[model samples]
Target: MVVLAGIQEGKDAIVEEGGIVALVEAIEDGSVKGKEFAVLTLLQLCVESVRNQGLLVSEGGIPPLVALSQTGSVRAKHKMITRN
Candidate 1:
């Protein structure tokens, strides 16, 4: 999904289908790897698109992201920081 999100069409389809909300939910409740995947997908989805960025925020994505940044696995933290 992260790889797919890198494509414009893939990202738009995901967003149109409410994937942002789903991904946010995953970030809130998923396992360590799941959270990392969610954040990476969201990063790709939001990368040059303000609409997706706003959608991510509207879905309450920030608090969970902050928590993940602080307490998630070291790999996840590195991924978030590097946006990779």
Candidate 2:
């Protein structure tokens, strides 16, 4: 709920947008399992954020995201890998 609210408020910004950070934090904190459906959704958003920010592949974020691509149902991996 709070994460959604943050996203709504910063609808323009990409990375600094509170919603993206909130969702990432939620996933890292392991609180989003009930919202497991959000994993793919958040990945899509993060890809967009990385693209818009022009983040390098060597950056810290790419590793975990790539690792994430190895798990989950095929559809989830599909979404994450397609962006790479």
Which residue window of length 10 is worst by lDDT in model 2?
Answer: 52-61
Number of backbone collisions per candidate: 0, 0
Stretches off by above 4 angstroms in model 1 are none
Report the lDDT tens digits of candidate 2 across residue range 7-60.
633434444444455444444444334224445545444444555234323234
Q: What is the TM-score of each candidate against the true structure?
A: 0.96, 0.41
Quote model 2's TM-score: 0.41
In terms of TM-score, the best-performing candidate is 1
